[model samples]
Target chain A: MRITIIGSGNVATHLAAAFKNGGHRIVQVYSREIQNAALLAYHVKAEAIDRLQDIDPETDLFVIAVKDDAIFSLGLSLAPYKKLTVHTSGATALTVLSSIMPNSGVLYPLQTLSKNKEVDFLNVPLCIEGPDEQTTRILEQLAQTISNKVYRINSAQRKVLHLAAVFACNFPNYLYEVARRLLDKQNIDFELIRPLILETAQKVQENLPVEVQTGPAVRNDENTMKMHLQMLQDEPGLQMIYELLSQGIIKNTKDGH
Target chain B: MRITIIGSGNVATHLAAAFKNGGHRIVQVYSREIQNAALLAYHVKAEAIDRLQDIDPETDLFVIAVKDDAIFSLGLSLAPYKKLTVHTSGATALTVLSSIMPNSGVLYPLQTLSKNKEVDFLNVPLCIEGPDEQTTRILEQLAQTISNKVYRINSAQRKVLHLAAVFACNFPNYLYEVARRLLDKQNIDFELIRPLILETAQKVQENLPVEVQTGPAVRNDENTMKMHLQMLQDEPGLQMIYELLSQGIIKNTKDGH
Candidate 1:
């Protein structure tokens, strides 16, 4: 299968390499930044197209891996090609490409990607959606070649999944940063909490997080909670977050699960 | 080293086993619940004592692994023996035990403990603080036998570490639970986001979490944020949380990593 990748960012670079390694031909690479396009294209042995008009019309799939706002304009720009174009976005709708092309889909890889870090595509779950049955089947097969887990999720379900991913992934890291900051405030090394963090994650994988919950909030230890609040008196913003999250945990736990 | 455990709950059970495994003698086990004391004593090969007067003063260390409220009272009760005593609490001050015994300290394990789970104490950071140098040294040696990561954290620092663990471990699980609840509302399987959660955690461990931050929040994608808000219309409490967290992330990222 021949593929043309739009956008030369982390997601685009990683996906392009994964596809190339999976025995698919990368026909072209596009980026608003010419240097980024050239850099990724050099690796995949593809033409670096700075403009959308320079895209190869002959490729089997055109993956628009650009920013969310750029998806519509890029889809419209690639309308003439009329191939099975897809956008690798978790939140974008499949209909965004409907007016631009009759055959389009989504190939959202549900994993955090970085250009330098090599991604094990087989471990990444691909949430995909297509306009028709044939295209959906093709996308499923394509995703299966690169990933072990493939789900036929539509735009609505994908949006919810993306929202959940934010909570499960992004927000947790933010909390981690907050934890690190708190530790740093006391001239203490944050590395002390790494094992605890890793074990917390490992426990959730084996069982539901709610069942395995511990700490002051779960136990409703008011004395410790008060002590923590007193410690966070300086950082009112962090104090608010601490209180909100504690309350959230208490509310959830009280909701009978 | 002769040790007597003053609690029979999760922390006490795990610490007793770890001490026994580290080749120390558990001389006695005390608990408000007679059966709990008997059960833990049998495993640790220690005498079960319900009365404080029954405590053997010959023991080198009386490890108080009881609840926060019980610490003060229990310390007072054990004052008759006046053996080297330490309360395993993150929030409680070292002075709480000092009032009861001449040689008292803290043996707080900076990790979440549950009755069902067995933890590898070798890496769990033990935060030790004592009134005297000799007592501190002895406690440090005892902590080192079980854990590689031992720290001389004060009562204030221990409280901070405990608070940080809540953010890194407890609150993150609650956030995951929120996501799970959202999935349940839409009849979507919560399992779909597991890979994303796992990868997010892995990425943060490999790099600074701030470097790997991604999502509508970090990107400051207002349109997506609005859509998310609309989707969560029925859940006012969750909507508020989402707004605050999203705004917080945006603010944190804007300040530059």
Candidate 2:
């Protein structure tokens, strides 16, 4: 399949390569910054364009793999390309593209894409939604070429999934930061928590996390919680997070019981 | 070393088996409940006792690996065996044990230990703290037998480390639960998020997490955040968490910039 990637960020760079690896043609790479566009286009053997007006209309799929805020503007820019266009975003609505393009859909790869790291697109769940059935089918087939798991998720469901991803991936990473800072304050190496973090994540593959929940908060050991709160007096923000989350967990446990 | 495990919890069971694997003899196991004691003792090749009066003073180290609240009481019960006691807790002060023993120390294995899952003590950080120089040296040597990394962390530092583990391990696991429930609401398999979660975690090892942070929250995409809040109106508690954490991340980013 012929493709035009409309972004030069991490998602666009990674996806362009993955598509190329999957035996698809990357015909063009677009970016507001000419250097970024040229960088990705160089790797994919494609044309680099700073302006969307320069986009080749002959491409089979136009992927608006830019930031959430830029999707609408990008769609408007690519309005002349009546070809199938999709954005690689979880939170943005499919209508954002359909509002401009005659043929539009979503080709959201449900994974955190980074330029430094090459992701296994085959494992990523590609969420596809479209303005019409034909475009949806084409987008679905396109996604299935790179990924084994494909889902027909509408805007509402996709938004929920995106929100859930925030809790699962983004919030947890912040929690890790908090942990690292706490340990660093006491001259403790953050590496010490690596094994524990990995094990905690691994447990979810085998068991329901609620069933496997352990620690002072879930157990409602008030004494340990009190001591931790006292220790965290210097970090009022973290203390607020700890207190709220613990109360939430305890309330959840009681409701379960 | 003739080790007597004075608890039948997850930490006690893992430590007893690890010691046994390291060719040390587990003399006995003690618990408030006889069944709990017997279950662990059977695995460690030791006798089980329900009463404190039944404790034999012949063991080299009487490990008070009980709950945080029970440590002081259990230590008081074994006060006669003064100079031969230790507790495996990062949060509790060594003085809690010293009040009941002439020699006492900490042998905190820095990992989240679960009863069902087996742990490789060799990789777990053993944070050892003792009252006197000789006792500290002996404890360090004992720790070296099970783990490659051993630190002489005082009570103040160990408590901080414990608090850090709560953020790293416990809080992340809780966030995972929140994600699972949110996905469940949309009839999306929570498993779809697994690869993303794994990749998010793997990224930290390769790059500085703050540099690699990408999400609607991290991007400060107010439009997406507002839409998510509207979608999550039914889940007020989760909504609050999402809003507050996003605010915190945005604040951090502003400061960073």
Candidate 3:
């Protein structure tokens, strides 16, 4: 399969390499900046293009791996290709791309991507969606070649998954930052909490997160909660977050969710 | 050193086993219920006692491993011993025990402890505090016998560390529970997000969390944030949490935190 990757960002670089490594032909790489395109294109043995007119119309697939807001506008350039165009976004709906391209689909990788950090795509779940049965099947086949887990998720379900990913991945990383800052102020080493963070995530692999949840909030230990709140009094932002999340945990536990 | 473990809960059980494994003599295990005490005592080859009168006053140290609220009352019951009594609590002040026992100190382990889950004491940071330098040194020596990391943290510093732990470990686990529920409602397997969660935590091991954070919130992508808010309208509690955390993340990013 010949593929043209649009965008020179993290997702674009990762997908380009994965496809090439999986024995698919990456025919071209595109970016507004030619240098950015050439950097990734050099490794995949593909042509790099800065101009929209230079895109190869003969490729079997066009993957728009740009930012969430840029997907629709950048996708407009690919309408002339009339190929199966897919966007690698979790938040954007399939209809957004399908509206411009008749053979549009979604090949969203359900994992965080970083340019410097290499990920094993085989374990990442590929959430696929298409406008028609045949298109969906073709996307699934391609997805299976790169990933072991593939799911046919509709637009509405995909939106919810994207929201959940923010909570599961993004919010926790911010909380870790907060923890690091708090310890930094006290001259405590941030490495002290790395094991706890790793073990907390590892526990979820074998058990439901709710079942393994521990801390003052889950145990309803008011004394510790009060002390924590008192300690964060100077930092109103952290205090507000602490209160809201603790209440959420209590409510969820009471509701048996 | 001869150690008497008061309370047979998660912390007590782990500490008892670690102390025994470090070649120290565990004098006794104490609990309100005889069965609870006997269960842990059998593993450490120590006597089990339910009554305060049965506690051996000759022991070198008495480690109080009860709940936060119970620590005060339980410590009063053993006031006759007048030994170096220490409570393994994060939120409670070191002065709380020092006020009751003249030779009190703190032997707080800065890690989450679960009875069924075995943890290596060598990596767990043992925070020690005492009324005097000699007692602090004694606790530090005992901590060093089982763990490599030991620090002399005061009550105020320990309280802050505990608060940071809540944000790093407890709050992240709650967010994971929220993600699990959202995916469960859509019939999506929660296993799909496990790799993301692990990688998110793993990133912190090599880089500062603030430098490595990624998501709509950190990027200030209002479009994705607005869509997420709209999707979470029905669940007001979750929506409120989402708004507060996102706002906090944006504020932190803008403030160059």
Candidate 4:
């Protein structure tokens, strides 16, 4: 399969490498900055192009791994090519690509990606969506080559999944940052909480988060919760978050959901 | 060292096993429920007693591993023994024990413990605080026998650490529950986000949480954030949490802290 990757960011770099390693020919790499395109193109042994006009029209697949807002414009630019196009975004709808190209799909990898960190694509869950059965099947085949888990999720479902990902992956990380700041004020090393964080995440794999939930909030220990709120008295932002989340937990526990 | 564990809860059970494994004699285990105490004592080859009067006064160290509110009363009850006493609590101050017993200290483990799970005490950070230099030294020696990471954190510092932990461990798990509920509504398996959660946590181990923070909140992507808010309209509690946390992230990122 011939592939043309449209972007030079983390997702683009990782997808390009995974495709190249999976025995697919990366025909071209496109980025506004030629240097960025060339860096990823060089690794995949593909041609690097700065403009959308230079994209290989004959490529079997065009993966737009750019930012969420950039996808629609990029799709508009590549509409005339009528190539099989997909965007690696969890938030964007498949219509964003299908409205531009007859053959459109989604190949959203449900994992955090970083340029320096090597991702095990085999373990990453690829959420695929397409307008037609054939388009979905083709994308699924390609996704299965790289990932073990492939789901044919529609645009609406994908959006909800993306929102959940924000809660699961994004919000918790922000909580971690808050934790780091709180520890920093006391001159305590953040490493002390690393084990706890890892174990908390690991628990969710085997047990439901609600069933395994523990802490002052779940236990309804008013004294501890009051003390924690007092500790964050100066930081209104953190205090609000702490209070709301505790209330949410208590309500959820009572509701038994 | 002769030790008496004055509770049979999660922390008490784990601590008793770890101390016994470290070659210390667990002289007795005490609990209001004799069955609970016997369950833990049986594992450590020690006697289980429900009454405080049955507590071995000759024991070198008495560990009060009960609820936060119960610690004070327990300390007062054990004060007549005049033996070294410590409580396994993070939120409670070290003075709570010292005010009751002359030989009071803290052996608060910084990791979450469960009865079913086998804890690697070697990696658990044991926060030790005592009234005097000798008491501190003795607690440190016992802590070193079972764990590699030991800190002489003061009561105030430990309180802050405990607060930070609520954010790091407890709040994040609550966020995960939020994610799970969102996915449940869409009939999406929560397993899909497990990889993302694990990787998000793994990043914090090697990098500062601030440096590695990602998502619409960190990027200040208003479109995605607005869409997520709309999706969560039915869940007002979750929606408020989402808005406040996103605002917090944007402010923190802009402040460059």
In TM-score terms, which candidate is top?
A: 4
**Leading candidate by DockQ:** 4
For each model in turn, which proportion of the native inter-chain contacts is also found?
Answer: 0.71, 0.68, 0.77, 0.84
lDDT by residue (B32-121, candidate 1, tens digit) is 788999999999999998887788888988899987988999888877776888999887889998976898999998887777777888
lDDT per residue as tens, model 1, A185-230: 8888878887777777766776777877888887788888888888
How high is each candidate's TM-score? 0.95, 0.95, 0.94, 0.96
* Residue B123, candidate 4: C-alpha displacement in angstroms: 1.0
Counted clashes in each candidate structure: 0, 0, 0, 0
Poorly placed runs, candidate 3 (over 4 Å): none
Please state the CAPRI-style docking class of candidate 4. Answer: high
Query: Could you give the candidate ranking by DockQ, starting with the highest?
Result: 4, 3, 1, 2
TM-scores (chain A) of the candidates: 0.96, 0.95, 0.96, 0.96
Q: Distance (Å) between predicted and true CA of B70, model 3? A: 2.3
Poorest 10 consecutive residues of model 3 chain A by lDDT? A205-214
lDDT of 2 by residue, B1-257 (tens): 99999999888989999899888999999999999999999998899999888988888988888888889988887887764789998779999988767888899988877887776788888899998899999999998887887889999988888888888778877888888888897798888887777777777766656666778888888888998899889978878788878877787788793
lDDT per residue, candidate 4, B1-257, as tens digits?
Answer: 99999999889998999899899999999999999999998999999999988777778988999999999999999888888889999999999989767899999999877777677889889999999899999999989988999989999999999998889988999999989888998899898889888888888888877777778887788999999999888889889999998998898899997
Give the winner by lDDT: 1 or 3: 3
Candidates sorted on TM-score, descending = 4, 1, 2, 3
lDDT of each: 0.86, 0.84, 0.89, 0.89
